[model samples]
Target: MKIPERYQPKNNKSFASYWQPTKDNLLPFLLPKTNISDSEKLVPYYFKVDDLADEVAVEYFTNTPFNQAIAKLHTDFSLFPSNKNRLSLATQNLFQQLNEVPSWVDFDLVNLGTSYCNRTGTAALSVLRNYCLMGGYESSAINKPLIFTQALHKGAVKRLADTVDFWMYVTEINGLKPNNKGIYAVLTTRLIHAYSRIQIEKKSEWKSELWGRPINLWDMLATNLGFSIAFIDGLSKLKFKPTAKELEAVLHLWKYVGYLMGIPLHLLPNTGEEAAKQLFLWSKSQKGIDTDSKQLAWALYDEPLRVTFTKNKIMKWFVQKTNLGYNEVLLGTESRQELALPYSKAKYWILFLNKINEYFDTKAKSNPDYYNKIAKQGRKAQEKVWKLYQQAK
Candidate 1:
C-alpha cells in the first residue's frame, strides 16, 4: 500500500508506534479487539477531508449566494440551493443530505439522550471540559489547525463560551430537527471547517504533507467520539450511572450529529464497542502532548476565573479549585504535570461531590417525577451559565 503525502504522520516515531496493536482502548465493555495489522490498513483515512463540504467551500468563495442559501437553512432546510444559486452539484448534494433524515435516527431516543445529558448537568460539563476537551490536548497534530488559526488570540475562555453555546444548541430538544438552529449550527460548522482548510493551506507554515486536511474526517470522528464514548468514560469515573438505553441514545444522537457535520455514517459508531474501535484505530498516529497541548490545557484550566458567569472572587476561586480537583482525579498526575496544571489537594473534593450526586441521582432514578424535576433544573442551570457566557467580554 502506498502512503500518500497527505496521509504522512508529522512524527515518524508516532506513526511507527501506531502500527503496533494495543489492547487498551476505553471502558470495560467498549474495549476494542484489535488485530496487529489493523492500523496499517486504515492509514489513509487520516488525510481524508469532507469532499462534499470542501467543494462547497471552493464554490462558496466564488458564489456568494451559496452563503445565503446556507444561512436560509437556519429557518428552513427544505429550500434546496440548487434552484436558487445555481449551486454546484456538490453544494446541492450537501443540501439534499441535510434535508433527508437518515432512517436510523430515533427522535425519542435522541431526546432521551438530551434529557440524560441535562440530568447530569454540571458533571457533564466537567467531563466535557476537563477530560474530553482538555485532555484531548494530548494530540500534537490534531490541534495544529487551532494553533495555525491563532485560536489562542481568542483565548480558551471565549472558545469555551462558544463551544458551550454550540453544545447547548445541538442538545436542545428537537434541536437537530430540520428548521432548527441545531441543524443550522452543524451545517455552518461543516462549512467553517472546510473554509478553515482553505485558509490554512494558503499559509506557508501549514504542512499538508504531514498534518493532512484541516478538520479532516478522521479529526471530526475523533472529536465526535470525544462527545459520545469518551464522554461516557469520564462520566463513569464520576460514578454517574447511565442506563443502557441512555448510553445507546447518546451514541445514536451523536452519530446523527456527526453525519450532519459531514462525517461518514459508516465511520460513526453504532455502539460503544464500535466507538472504542474507531477511537483506537485513529489514535495510533497521534503524537503525545506538545507545546500546543500544554497551552490549550492551561487556558482551559484558567477559564473558570476568566468567565463572567460569576464575578464573586470567592466563588470563582472555589470553582477553579474544584475543576483542578476534577483534573487531578480524571487526568491523573502524569497528565496533569505534562500540561503544567498547578498542584492542588482539592482533588479530595470529588469524594464529597460524588457522594451528594450519587444520593440525588439514585433518588431521581427511582422516581420519575423527581427525575423530571432535576432534568428541568439541570437545563435551567445550563441556560443561566449560557446567558452569562453571552454577556462576557
Candidate 2:
C-alpha cells in the first residue's frame, strides 16, 4: 500500500507520532515561533515551559489531602543543603576510615572498588531521573522539609504511599483514572524490594576500604535506577492504558537514566552496548579509572543490551513475575482473590496484552483482530481504574 503524503513522516515527527505526542511536542512546535534556527540553541526557547510552574492541590484526595504531599514533604525536609551537608560530612567521616594506602592507590579511587558506593550513585541517579522525568521543578521554592521527610521515612510502605499520592494527583489533573492497580503496585513493591536487596548486599560486603572494608554505596544510588529500568520497560509493553502524563513520566525517567549514565538522550530504539556506552561514560567520568576497569564493566553488562533482551528477556522475566504476583488470578493461575485489588480490572485485562505480544514474538505473527480485542479489554479496564481513583478522591 502506498502511504499517504500527509501521513508519511517528514521529520522527527515520524518517531514522535509513533509514540503519540504528550507535552514534549509543544516545545518543537514553539521553536519555529521563537525564530531559533539552531536546534541546540533552541534550548532557551523552553523557558516558557519552565516558567509555568505553580503548586496546586488536588482538592479531592481523601486518603491524602495534599497532592504529591509525600514528595513535597521529602523535598521540604530531607533534601535541603543542611541535610546534604550533613550527609556529605557523614560520607567524609566514613571516607576517613579507609586505610591510608600509598599515593598510588589514591583515596577517591576507593569508591570504584566499593560496589556499595557505585550502587548508591546509581540509586541517586534513578531518583534524580525520576524527578526530572516528572518535570520536578528545580526551584528554590521546593520545600526542604519534604525532602527530609522522604529521606527519613523509614518504612517502605509509607514511602510507597507518598509516591502513590503523587501519581494520584497527576492522574486527577490530567482527567484520567488511576487505572492499572497491578502495574503500579507491583512496580512500587519491586522497587522497595530492590532497596532491601541493596541494603542486604551492602551489609554483607561492608569491609574496611584499605583494610579490605566492604563497600556500601550499592545501597545508595545505582540499585534503584538499574533495577527499575528493567521493570519499567517491561510494564510499558504490557500496559493496557496509561495516561499521557504517566507515559511522559516514564519516558522522561528513562531519558534521565540515559543522561546520568553518560548516554546521549537522543539514542533511539534504546538498545545495545552502544547504548551502554552512555552509562559507561557516567562510570568512567569519575576521575582516575584506568582503561581496563571501563572495558570490563561494559563487557559484563553487554548481554543485557542485546535486541533479544527486549523480546525474550524482558517478556520472560516480567511474565514470570506477573504470574507469581497477587494479580495472577487474571492469568488463570490462582482463583481471583476476594481481597480488594488495587487495579483489579486492569490486572486481568493486562494478561491479554501479554498474550498478544507473546504471539507476535514467539510466532512472528500479527493478528489485528487479537490486538483489537486486547485493546478493547484494556479500554474497559482503564475506565474502571479511572473511576475508582476519582471516586476515592
Candidate 3:
C-alpha cells in the first residue's frame, strides 16, 4: 500500500511538535475482524519469512554444536576468521544478517532516549505494565492461540518480567550491538513467532480464521505502537510530561527496535501524529475484543497486584487504587466496561494525590536520586516476584 501523504513527516518545526490528542483524535481501541483480502495484500512485504527458513540459515541456527561455536565468536570477535572456513555457508549468511544494523540509526538520539527512560524511572514500568500489556491483549489477533498459550496463560509475573527485560535490554547501549544479548533475544523471539506461524497455520482452528498467519505485519506494527505511542500516552495521562526531544528520541529508539524485530520500515511512523494515524488504522482493521482478550486483560491487571501486594496493606491499597484510576482514564470507559472493571472514586483520588506528590517531589529535589531510589525498589520487587513465580512452580 502507498503511504499516505499526510502521514509522511514534514520538514518543519510545526510538523515536528508533540502531538496533542483531542477527543476526535482518539480512535476506538477495539479489535476489528480480520479481512483476508487485506492480509493477503500485505503478506509479501510484512510477513516474509523465506530468509529465516533458508536451508543454510535453519541448519546454522538449529545445530547445537554450531550454535555454541557462533556464541563463542559472538562474544569474542577475534574468534571469527579462525572458524571462518569451518563455518557452513548458512552460518556465514546468518552472521551477516545479525551484524546488519539499520543505516538510519543515530547514536546521539539513542543516548538521549536512554536518558529519557532513566528520568522516567519506575513510572515507565507502571505505564508498560498497565497500558502497553493490557492494550496489547485487547488485540484479538495477538490474543490468539499461539500467543495466548505461550504467554498470557503462562503465569503473568513471568510474562511481565520477560517484557521488562526486553525493554531494559533494548534501551541500553550495550544491548544494541550486533551479536549482543539483546539482539540475540529479539532475533530468537522473531524466529519463535515465525515457527509459531508455520505450526499454527496448519491447525484447524487457525485455518478457520480470516487471516492465515498467526502474527502478520499489521499485528507487528500495532504491537510496536503499543510500546511507543501507547507508552507515551500513558505517561502523559499520569502527568509525567516529557520534552519534545525526549519524545522524539523515545520514538526513534523504538523505531530501531522495530527494525531489529523484523517489522517493515515503511509501516513505522516517523512522528507522533503519524503514529496516531497508524494506530487508528490498526484499530479499524481489527474486530472488537474477544474472549481471549478479556481473559488476558484481567490476568494482566490482577496478577501484578496479587504478586506485589502480598503484604503492606496500605501500600497495596494505594497501588491498586492508583492502577484502577490509570486504567480507567487511559483505557477509556468503553474498555473499562468491556473488561468488567468498575470505577473507584477512592482510586481516582489516590491517583490525583500521587500525581501531586510526584510534581512536588520533582520540584523539591534533583530527579537522579529519586530515580535511583525507585529503580532500587523496583529491582527488589521484581526479584521477589520472580522468586514467588519460581516457588509456585
Candidate 4:
C-alpha cells in the first residue's frame, strides 16, 4: 500500500535512517499462525525429472564448507562482492556449504528462492522446493518433513513467468489494477540483466557505455515478479502453522531483500546489505512520495539511475532514452490475471518435506542457538511423525 510523502524520510538520508516497519510500509513483520505443530498430516506434491536439479539446496547456514563464509556475508553484501578474490572466496564458501554446487546456480536460483521467502512469503515446504529444486538433492537430511507425490513442472525460467502471475494475484488481492504490460516488461528487463551478468562474468567484458542504457522495463518487471511471488509464498506459509523462530528468520530474510530491491526503509519489509547505502539514500530522498503506489512508482522511476551508478556516463544515455521506453509502455499488454492457475499435485509432498529440512538446516546454522532450542523439540516431534509414516509406508 502507498502512503503520503510527508511522513517518509527525504533529504537523501541513508536507508539506515529510515528503514523501520510501520503499519502500511513495504514489508511489515508478520506474526505467525497460532495453531502450528510438527505432527500435522501432510498432503502430496511430486517432483519432475525434466528440471533435473539437486534433491534440495545445501544448508549454507549449517554444515561444513560454506557456513562460516555465508555467516560472514549473510548480512553483508558489500564485502562479499568487493573484489575477484572476495567474490571467489564468497563463492567458495557458498560452494562448500552447498555440496560444491556451481556459483551461478547458488545466486541465480537457490538464493533467489530464499530471497523470495523474504519478498512474498515465508520459507516453507512448497516454497523452498519450488525455488531450489529440492527433489534433486541426494540426502535424507533434505527429506525430514511432509512428503507429497504430485507433479510440478517448474524451473528458473518458469519461476520467472510465474512471478509475473503472482504479482497480478497480489494486486488483485489488494483491489488494485495492474499495468497491462507490466509483467512482460519486467520479465524482459530481467532477461537482459541476466544475460548481461552472464556475458560479463564469462567474457570479462565491461562496457561503460552499456551501463547507462535504461533497463528494458520488461526485464526489470520480471525480476520484481520473481521477488514478489517468492515473498508471497513465504508469507502465506506463515498464515499456516509455523514456529515463532521460523517466522522471525523469515522476517529477517525478507527485510534483507526489500532493502536490496530499493524498498523504502520505513516500509518494514526486511533488511538487506548495508552496502545498499546509496540506493537507500535515494529512497530516503523520495520520502515525499508516500503511499504504497506512489512510493512504488517513485522507486520504479529511480530504477534506471540505480542500475547505472552515478559514476557511469552511460546513465546519461539511458536518461535520454526514457521517451523510447515510455512509448513502448503505451503498447497494449497482456493481462496475466486471466491465465489458468498451475496445478499442484500430490507427489510434491516429498519435495516439500525435503525443502522444509533444507530451510531448517540453513536457518539453524545461521543461528545455531535459535535453531537448537527449536531443534530439540522439533526432532522429537519429527521422529513421532516419521514412525507414523513408516507404518503407512
| Among all candidates shown, the one with the greatest lDDT | 1
Q: What TM-score does prediction 1 earn?
A: 0.88
How far is 86's C-alpha from truth in model 4 (Å)? 17
Off by over 4 Å in 1: 1-26, 61-86, 308-310
lDDT agreement of model 1 with the native: 0.75
Q: Give model 2's TM-score versus the native structure.
A: 0.25
lDDT score, candidate 4, position 67: 35
Model 1 clash pairs are: none
Query: In model 4, what is the error at residue 227, expressed in angstroms?
Result: 5.1
What lDDT score is found at residue 359 in candidate 4?
Answer: 66
Cα displacement (Å) at residue 150, model 4: 29
Residue 84 lDDT, candidate 3, scale 0-100:
65
Ranked by lDDT from best down, the candidates are 1, 3, 4, 2
1 against 4, candidate with superior lDDT: 1
lDDT of 1 by residue, 9-109 (tens): 34433322212332321354565666535656666666788888888777655445755745654433345653646555686788778777878899999
> At residue 321, what lDDT does model 3 achieve?
66
| TM-score order of candidates, top first | 1, 3, 2, 4
